[model samples]
Target: MIKTAFALSFALSTCMVLPALGAEQFQCPLPSNPNDPAKLEQIRGLLPDVNTMKNIERLNATIATLRRDGVSKSLMIDHLVGAYCLMVVREAPLTEAEKAALVRRFTGQVTRLVYSLESGLDIIINVPLTPDVVDAVNSVAEKQGLSGPAWIAMTIDDALQQQRTTSPPELPAGFSSSC
Candidate 1:
C-alpha cells in the first residue's frame, strides 16, 4: 500500500485555510524547528486573508499555470488541495463536521497524489509479455519478496547505475574526474 503525505498536507492546508487573526486554533505558537523559528514565522505570516471569491478564482488560475509549466503533480495537488481546504474552512471555522467533510473529499486525491509522486510520476505500464518473460520476472521478483512493479523499478535503477559507472564521462584535456 502506498502512503500519503497527509501529515504534511494537513499542516500546510490548515495554515492556508484560515486567517491567523483571532484564530487561536490555527496558530502555531511554537515552531516545529527551534533552529528555524524565523522561517516558520515567515511562513505563518504569509498565509493570506483569502476570504473573497475573486481570490479563489485567482488561486485556481495560478494552479493551472503551474500545471502547464510542468510542475510536479504532487506539488500541484498539494496546492490544489490546500486551496480547497481554505475555501471550505473559510465557509465555516474549524469544526469537527467541517474537518470530516474535508477529509472525505480529499483523502483519496491526496493518496493518489503521494503515490504518483513517490513512484517518480511514471505511468504504470502493463506490458503484454510472452509466457517465458512472465515466468522469468515472476520467478526473480518472488525470490526477492517483491511485487512485479517493485522488482521492475529496482531492476531499472540497477541497470541505470551500471550504465553510469561503465560509461566514460567526457572531460577536458588534462582533466579527469575522480568520481
Candidate 2:
C-alpha cells in the first residue's frame, strides 16, 4: 500500500481526508532523508503548521500543490504519517489530550485509507497515550524501523504474549498443570 499513500476519503468522524494522486513522472520536492535540516525546512515551508494541517480542506490544497510540484506517493504517505509522529515527539506545548486526539484522528484516517475500514462499517482502534508515553513510542518506533500504529501493535503483542488473568482458570479435577 506504499503506492496508495493514503490518498483517501475517510469514513466517519470529521478528521483529515487525503487527495488522489495522478500518474505523471515529476521530481519530488523534498529530499530523501527526512532528518536533514533542509528537508525539515522544506516541509515547514510547503505544508504549513500543525494547526493548518488539521484542516482537511487546507491539507487537500497543500497536497495538490505537492502533487503539482511532484512528490512521490510513498514519500507523501511517510511524511504525512511521520508529520504527526514527529509532532508528538517535539517539545511543542501540547497537552496529553491534544496529542492523543491528534493520534486518534490520524490513525483513523490512515486505517480508512489503507483498509477502507470505518466507524460502524468496521472496527477501529483509537489509542490514547500520555505525552511522555507518546514521545517514547515515537523514539522506539524510529529505532526499530517501525512507525505509527504498527509500533503500538507490536508493543501490545509483546506485552500480551503471555496472557494473564486476575485469577487462573481452574482445572477439571484435583490435578493442576504448569503453563
**Candidate 1 global CA lDDT score:** 0.44
Q: Residue-wise lDDT of candidate 1 within 1-179, one digit each (tens)? A: 11122232234344333334454443212222346444333322333433322354554454455556664444444444444444445555566455534533442333232333343666776767768766766665544334455545545543444456699666899887775
Give the alpha carbon lDDT tens digit for every residue of 29-142 in model 2: 232345656545455565555554467676566555555766543344445555554555363576544555555555445332432222376545885777876776666454
Model 1 poorest ten-residue lDDT run = 1-10
- Cα RMSD (Å) per model? 12.6, 17.8
In model 2, the runs with Cα more than 4 Å from the true position are 1-37, 88-93, 107-179
TM-score of each: 0.31, 0.35
Q: What's the lDDT for residue 178 in model 2?
A: 68
Best candidate (score: lDDT)? 2
Candidate 2 has an lDDT of: 0.46
Model 2 error, position 74 (Å): 2.1
